[model samples]
Target chain A: SQKIEQNSEALNIQEGKTATLTCNYTNYSPAYLQWYRQDPGRGPVFLLLIRENEKEKRKERLKVTFDTTLKQSLFHITASQPADSATYLCALPTDGGSQGNLIFGKGTKLSVKP
Target chain B: DTAVSQTPKYLVTQMGNDKSIKCEQNLGHDTMYWYKQDSKKFLKIMFSYNNKELIINETVPNRFSPKSPDKAHLNLHINSLELGDSAVYFCASSQGQGAWEAFFGQGTRLTVV
Candidate 1:
């Protein structure tokens, strides 16, 4: 069976520091990987997406890197703030299936302290 | 305007009852999806519809049915809901079927009593 895993524990960091989250998958290769931010009692908002062919992607203060060889993706939030405190989800498409259908990991909750 | 939206942010119902949750997207996307987030915060895909056609249906129970009136709307109806069905239901939309960004709606929290 295919599985996606992230750090199950919460990540705490001080404001202005960089926060890094890891996503690892096994037994499948995805065409693209995506990152999303979700707040309490709300839906997830799209942040950035990086393709397997691309090494990294950036948007504003967020950056994502995909390593198909390692079967992992790393999400970085630079110059983080208290507002950046939320659960970050990493999703990937299944092997040759519905593009809209994504397998998501149990997101890692980040808490930024001021 | 909201890109993707769902009605009744909170729903409290009893087991064995039937209920429906509505979803709509104004982005004119071609594909729509339904996802469920359980208490453990594990998100899983349930169904996907493209242009009013069923494109993907995960190993979801038959009791849960998805009705897509058009490309912009997909609703989920649960028959004889059970206590295990309690979770946050999310609706999302994308432009095409291949590796595109998705816009998600504020999820509807369903609690079975």
Candidate 2:
């Protein structure tokens, strides 16, 4: 069975600092990994998606690094602001087809204090 | 306009009752999915539909049934809902079966009393 583990504890960081969250998986080799931001009572919003062949992907202040060897992915937010505070989820394709489902991590709740 | 939307943003129903939640995606995607987020915030995949066909069905209980009348719609019906079924249900869609990004709806917060 495949499993993904994230920091269950909330991460509290001051504004303007860089926040790094991790997602580690076991028993699966995901070809593609994605990141999503979910606010309270809202659905998960797509953030970034990176392939196993890509070392790192960045969008504005957000950066995602995929390490296939370790079966881990790191999500980074630079210049973090209070608006960036939300639960970040890491999702990966569970099966072969595009119609296949995604296995999501438990998610890491990030709190940016101003 | 909303890309993906679900009806009754919040649902409060009694145990043993039957209820249905509807979902529609205007993104013209070929694949749609139902996901359950538990109280602990662990999101689990319940079902997946591609072009009105079932593709992925997790180990969901028989009490739960998903119907896709069309490629853009996927509805979940729960029979004899149990107290343990209380959670948020999300509907998502992607461009194709192999698409990476999935657009999600606001979610339906179902509370079984």
Candidate 2 ranges beyond 4 A from true positions: A96-98
Pairs of residues clashing in candidate 1: none
Which runs of model 1 end up more than 4 angstroms from their true locations? A96-98
Give Cα distance to truth, residue B3, candidate 2, Å.
Answer: 0.7
Q: TM-score each candidate.
A: 0.97, 0.97
- Minimal lDDT window, size 10, model 1 chain A: A93-102
* Candidate 2 structure quality by residue, lDDT tens digits, B1-113: 99999998999999999999999999889989999999988899999888888887899999999998888899999999999999999999988776459999999999999
What does candidate 1's lDDT look like per residue over A1-114, in tens digits? 789999655999999999999999999888888898999999988898888899999999899999999999999999999999999999988653346588899999999999
Query: Local error of candidate 1 at A17, Å?
Result: 0.8
**In terms of DockQ, which candidate is strongest?**
1
lDDT of 2 at B108: 99
